[model samples]
Target: EGEWKVMLFTCSYSVGGVHGHLVDYMQPEAVSTLLGMTYGEYDKRYKSYFGDVIRKTFFDDVGFVHMEQTWTPAITEIFREKYGRNPALYYPALFYDIGPETGAARIAFYDIRSELMAEGYVRQVSEWSEARRMRSMGHPPENYSPNSVVAHGDILKYYRHVDIPLLDAILCFRRGLNGFKQVCSAADLGDKPVVGAELCGAYPEEMDSAMLYRTTLEAMARGVNFVVSHGMWYDTDPQTVRIPPLIAPENPLLGPALKGYSTSTGRSCMLLQGGRRIADIAVLWPINAIQAESYMFRDAESGLPIANWHPNDVVNYALSGMLTNDLHRDFTYIHPENLTDGKVSVEGDRLRLNNAENLQEYSVLVIPGGGYISAGALARIGEFYDNGGKVIALASLPS
Candidate 1:
């Protein structure tokens, strides 16, 4: 079974003066209105709401719950508690250039939002699942792109509590394939045994068995050990089917090969599961740089204020292609949060991620040209370099 938390696009709630939609660009007025309210009131209310829903679902014998599109707006109270400052003071900086402090304010704003979503919602659900001996998994929207700054703050932190770090691969085989590394890297850092991909939804109706197999192989090659084919439709009548290329037996073109394909994938997973990936390069996720550079501007076409485009947005995507296809070097993304939290450290001329299951040691660190970096991460990078580890800065250096 599946459940959506906080924001579901169509329906959502305001928690602590934070509107579920447009989280990244909330105005001062919206946040100021909640100042008179008691601290933690909205947080408690949200916890109650989540607890009630999960309790009822679990009572009905559902062993697993996939929390879909999990994200939260920046709660004013949470911002104050976590950052020790009133978020209303920095509202302008979050959306526009106010002064020299704009960049720093933007980074702090997004950072707290990321922490809130991970701790308040994701961690709560994960703990509940652990207690109940069930499992929790899901991926936020735009998990692959720079839009993740607006969608969920930071991808790695967003999956801090997920039992299986999952990524959504939709449309054609090639689209969004670059995102597999992000999810797989999260699983690797967290020492998660399984990495999942929701495969091949919204592909063309003519998509054949070969396309399915190819997509599956691509995902596997990127460290995905579990595959959840998009769906089996209750009714596959061509006239009524909502999303095409159904995986059920009703699809005459692909049904006959499903059993063999399933067996092949199973065999592949059997060999790959519980294995550690060896990558000599550690690519910094550059989330702080992305956050500092991102801001809302009015869209010329729609007249709506939207997150503006920036070159830093595609750095990871471009790097993924170059490293995987062109350079043919295996790499893993290291979140800056890990550095700040001391989960990553320098050891004997190598940067090491201290995961319980998959302890990764990197001889080189690649910073993908984002302008800003957290002080904690920069310190670690300095240590790595000073200790004789190779540090490669692409395009530009962090200020």
Candidate 2:
């Protein structure tokens, strides 16, 4: 029998508190409660509402076991319990909306509805996916790309746990080459060993094989491995569907164009996967700074980060987007928490990642500006500098 890989496309758990959103919230007072707090206060405690709540209820020492009755014993196994099922390759096709006012509204809705479980789901899903991937002979689980142009920093943050970073680069139409470059570069630097995650959104309406070939090569150059076309629809009547020609047979490009795309990108994936990267530059993610900026804007139209948004403030967002472009050498994110937690340490004038199997070393740490920072992280940076590690602060010191 042939193997089948299933793709589950859904809103990322990070968008709202995990127990599902309380979209039909009853209380107007709840919105007032959410708006009452300053962004800083919200930033520190947003997880308390969502992530922490789920961690206590769903996960335990043995890992994520499906204990909730609502999820189990259901006809479809909606909670994704893998028991009694054949081992099959599975990957998440994730998406979410953007903008500042939009993000603020999501947080407001969660606060009003008392559904604080959304923020922490991404990490939880990452853990669950890792466990499932281990159970699968060798199939890997790709990560969900963060929503919006500014929120892209979250994609880099995802690298800490996942091997693949899947981005829906075409959805925005605003996201073009610059966007894809930033995304692929981040994934290449992350834990992704050899093969990067699938890059979706190559539509025939957008471009044919020639454009596809060039795009695939560009991604490969930036370190993307596997490729999945934007999508294929079910065999319903062509008139019924809005977007067609997506490998739907009737689409004129399906015959040779699809075949050529599959052939070219598939071969490139084999050549790129399983390779190690070497880098001397460490990009320090301005975690607090990004959070600080995200609070300043509220985008109700799209939804808040469910937890928080990106470094929307001009300085940090622009800096982060272009930070890796001309670095000339490979670079990886230096999580501030990791620095404080000792996951990153100084060794003989070089900063080293302590947790990886092979160990990654970096000589320079570039900190993007504009966020509230922890004293512990500041001390760690001081330690790095004292140990002869180089530092590049974009505009202002973290404070």
Candidate 3:
């Protein structure tokens, strides 16, 4: 039996409860008896080690769960071992400018942190699920905003191992619609068959059938095929409820519409799933620029540390809104890592995004305004431009 202890931290927000942090999920000592083995050895034995739990659960799907701000001393040690340098040395650069190497250090810090999470935790669970004939699904917090860097490292890289990339869509409809394109883009780039939204959890009590249907359809139009309504409650007492908009048959207003909503959503998912997304434009995700531009500084009044808002933070959301709503043109976001890793390439007058199962060709490569870019991605863009592909640079050119 696994005897893992929860690490709790006080909630910073108004929710006012202690948040429990799980073990890094890669920690052999906490998870199983497979201690003192190298990661390679652990990987080989992971499936069989978890066989009893997998068999006992009798579940067709497994979730890796939400990984948000999951960092520890063990992670730092692994980071040092993997990168051959202590991450502590980069702290000055990570938070504030240290000199010429500051940008490079920040880039490396964020990149390695993202890589460690993806390889150490996310990929392990994903591969395990695949081996067990179960599907893996989940999302990191702040998945839809520039805050994704602080929360999940790199949103695109974070989802690389996930079988179904999910986005948490809470709050009101207007606010919830902001980051759907980003998650959908991850699914498209990965060639994953399904994209999920954990929707309508914290909406007001006034949330009606119209609001629910509108939100669902909007999410669907943005490339979501799976919807996990967040969620139904067992207890109907209003006093026991925490998150609002309780989705249950007991709810007097939205209850009667549940059955029909479920049916239509099912049909929608069946039609949208397993199809290649067709788009002529590919927006570069500019994660490199975002990482390079972001830094922490002390707040003026409270004297607390805070992250500065970079101008490029909302560029993705803005571009998505323009292309998707105004221009009526469809597009997908291609990550800078994809370009650097050779998953994306120049094919004559087109840029081809190729993965294990899906291939998408874009005629126009739209690079949004960010002053910094990875050299490898820049080289790929140059090659594409030289090969006669349309290159659109928004705001300013990346240095």
List clash counts for every candidate, in order.
0, 26, 0
Task: Quote the RMSD, in angstroms, for model 1.
Answer: 10.1
Summarize candidate 3's per-residue lDDT along 187-288 as a digit string, tens digits.
Answer: 888889898888888888878988889888888888899988875777878777788788888787889999999999999999999967788899998777
lDDT of 2 by residue, 1-399 (tens): 799754553322212443334221112243234333432254356544533433211111110111111111121232134234321221110013334333333322222111112113334334543433321011111122222222222444433443445444343222343334444544544545443323335344644556556656655655567665544566536575455335444565544677656776778788777646566777775545543333222322336432224444324344434644544345566666777777778786788876454357888887766545667878888888998889887766644
Evaluate residue 201 in candidate 1 and report its C-alpha lDDT on the 0 to 100 scale.
87
lDDT of 2 at 365: 85
Error of 2 at 304 (Å): 12
Q: Quick one: RMSD of model 2?
A: 17.4
Q: Mind sharing the TM-score for model 3?
A: 0.80
Q: Please identify model 3 stretches exceeding 4 Å from their true place.
A: 1-22, 25-89, 297-308, 312-314
Using lDDT as the measure, the top candidate is 3
Per-residue accuracy of model 1 over 1-399 as CA lDDT, tens digit each: 698433222325434442323322133333333321421354355545543454211111011011112224446677687778876777777546879888888888777667765664456556655654456777766665444565566778878888887787787777766667887888888888888777888888888899999989888878888878886777777767788878877888789999999999988887888957899899999777777866643122223223223454337777888898788788999998787786888896998889877888899888888788878788888888988999988888876
lDDT of each: 0.69, 0.44, 0.70
Better of 1 and 2 by lDDT: 1
Q: For candidate 2, give the lDDT of residue 377.
A: 76
Weakest ten-residue segment in model 3 by summed lDDT: 56-65
